[model samples]
Target chain A: MDVKPARRTDSHFVASLEKAMRVLEAFGPEQARLGLTELSIETGLDRSSVQRLTTTLHQLGYLDKDATTKRFSPSIRMTELANRYLWSDDLVKSAMPRLIDLRQALGETINFSRLDGTDIVYTARLPSSRTSYAAMIIGRRVPALNTSSGRVMLALREPGERQRAIEEWPMQRFTSQTTMDREAVKRLVEEAAETGYSIAENELQMNELALAVAVNRNGEPGGAIHCSVSGTVWTRERLREDVMPRLRDVANAIG
Target chain B: MDVKPARRTDSHFVASLEKAMRVLEAFGPEQARLGLTELSIETGLDRSSVQRLTTTLHQLGYLDKDATTKRFSPSIRMTELANRYLWSDDLVKSAMPRLIDLRQALGETINFSRLDGTDIVYTARLPSSRTSYAAMIIGRRVPALNTSSGRVMLALREPGERQRAIEEWPMQRFTSQTTMDREAVKRLVEEAAETGYSIAENELQMNELALAVAVNRNGEPGGAIHCSVSGTVWTRERLREDVMPRLRDVANAIG
Candidate 1:
């Protein structure tokens, strides 16, 4: 006889609350606004549930309904919640000054990111004096295997978790330099763990170079500080030999 | 015979959704993380309901639980949602480049804000090169009556709504220059409506000066863009003669 493991459900979890949050999550950068039907389809909730959740969210100041289009989009109050985190969250507060200094030292865009499941989300960004093709918006999400920050963060995870992620994460080829094979990706992650830093050259975008070092709080990886520059400005040797030290220093200060 | 007006409740409104959102709102900069009992007290929900809602929120990735203390806090996913608004929302996307230009032109901080209830929330902020004591984090909330952006946005509201807001808004004195008298605030808002601009000097902060103009989309107020500088650097005369026109031009470009 074959048996399957039972699913676990915490008795305290509210089903309605999860459904309501799912409704809000259905709206994103591509779909900034959605009508009730679209929301229903995206969240896999019925029309009545979507209507009820969206209406309640509107009343709570999270969703704004356009009168003409009759579509719901995130309201400004949503920003307030995030702003509170950026302002008061310990990790951001600790890293911001150092991140600014890193930007000044490298004359390149500086980013701070944290792992969110299999993706990395930019928590803060300081733009370079010179504009680049990369649009560094805070809260931007990218795949965990195609960026330096992701590799550093992934390497910092527990051994079992890192192995699971390496096996499960979808390795999409973003550019010619992108590594899709699991073994190559695993090698990169292991190298990051050994060297205390990670580098990505033209992995996510053409002619873009990024280096990242893990930030630790209480001796555990909290996030990462990364420096991104143009390939024309810094060759691979210079980034590894010259920039890596400064990045590690900044990470140490922040950690 | 006695008659009472009926309460407005859209048929699709969900009470659970509202309660869950309130739990999220209860965590602010002051209370960046909260325990279940504290959340219950702050949101005025029962402990069990707070637990259920917070648990569900944790599962949905909007909240994170601290392993040691079991406290709940807003997670990075919250920033992702807000970031989508800042990146993709029409008003913010249009105003940002102009706001950046305005910041460069005056060498002062520039802000984009919208009215939320009787308060104004900063939706985007571009800081000046020289930092000031004033904290200008995006999504910071302040009373509508005490800010130039607030006055400009309030002036753009429909007459009845504007009048109601003028009468109902809580007028608090931040600095001595804050307009606490309702009649005086109304006069200032009326003047802003007439001249297409607004100014607040030493109102919200003792040494800060701000000027604002409304941004319109489809011929109605979408939000307001404002410039802020130190009172020592700019007098009222200079603000009106040098800054107001440029601010108006930027607002027009954005609108």
Candidate 2:
């Protein structure tokens, strides 16, 4: 296993807390329940430490252990924290009603996502009635370069940070239509900035087309408001003519 | 100031990690964006420890510091964890579509909540068109004795634990109709268990009536599924005739 980064020696840094967070981070969309050995490998913590930390977390009502599986998963208490965290964001709170309105008006999924790390996390989502996919779930994260929301927010980032982010993120091709070429993606970001909106056509998934516009607060881009349409029904021309204007109107209203 | 509980002497328990969680817990519906002194007081940590923990949390992107106010709030990164945490619950994942269906049918706000501590935190919610209250926000906690969901879950708890919980929780009067009598609240819980459902009329709020049925998984009440209607619109007879059967049907289907 690859060795994890050495803990920061900064006096104020609580190593134990960081380690605990690392344990929590080890669980994701795929690895929901994990055993001690798996968690040890994932978090790069020793088995005993993982056991201790998981036990402590379980005792605190943050982690639940399945008696049959002998694996641990985050308990419902974490949902409380997640709910508070989303509502605490002023930008998210203000955009919610408007996002709901747009979802009703368009009959498509509506999302409000903010850039965090090299990804965009959906802070709020109103799923389309026809959607079978759970893509619009609040808190689901997608790659920064792969999503229209990410590209829209990345396009608005300060030049130096944007360049660093572009270089840092891996441009993996998710589908046949996904542009893995760095220069092509850079052009897409630039075009999005110039046009005040961005679109990703079957980049993340073969049957999805997403378009986004950045929501600004006091001239600073806070996040992106976006809508995803099923590619089976939506073409680029139709998306631009039908969905883009309403999306932009909502973003502008939020800004 | 009241003294905080002493840290467990167990070698496996990570004291610093627990302290950090306490800091996170300190920020709630009321106490968002707390300063160093306020956090110290809230967490019952010395100023220096609070400073170090908050600084570390800020650096890790879990907490964000406002440059002008010097107060810290949860950053967007925290939302990532929150998303993963909610998705980790099997009960929540299975109930989502059914909850959506019930919300549409009843045209009233639907909520799924689980008993946590002396409160019930909303695990999932689908708001009705006419709903204006944000009380159903996922993770929003309400008194277990005051809501139908809470009563349903509490009714199923071990008698000793339920009694202890009732003693522990502060039965604050939220409305004139809220029953503050402990014996009366216990009787409501007992009635819920006998009837296989629960109701709260003008309890938490003056004009809101809530009905709930336990989402049983393997005969154990896993959580409660509930719907709230404006008392102005929903009479007890209509609630029983129209909403109760549908609520019980969804709960049974999920179970």
- Top candidate by DockQ: 2
lDDT of the candidates, in the order given: 0.77, 0.79
Return the DockQ of model 2. 0.47
Query: Candidate 1: misplaced stretches above 4 Å?
Result: A1-9, A98-108, A128-136, A157-164, A232-249, B1-11, B101-107, B128-136, B157-164, B232-246
Mind giving the per-residue lDDT tens digits that candidate 1 earns over A16-110?
Answer: 77777677778777788899999999988999888888877776678889999999988877777787567556877766666656655565777
Report model 2's TM-score to 2 decimal places: 0.90
Which pairs clash inside model 2?
none
Write one digit per residue (lDDT tens) for candidate 2, span A149-180.
88888888787877787778856677898877
**Candidate 1: residue B118 Cα off by (Å):** 2.3
Query: How close to the true structure is residue A172 of candidate 1, measured as C-alpha lDDT?
Result: 71
Q: Chain B vs. true chain B: TM-score for each candidate?
A: 0.87, 0.90
Q: What is the C-alpha RMSD of each candidate to the true structure, in Å?
A: 4.6, 3.2
By TM-score, the best candidate is 2
Q: How many collisions between residues are there in candidate 2? A: 0
The TM-score values for the models, in the order shown, are: 0.86, 0.90
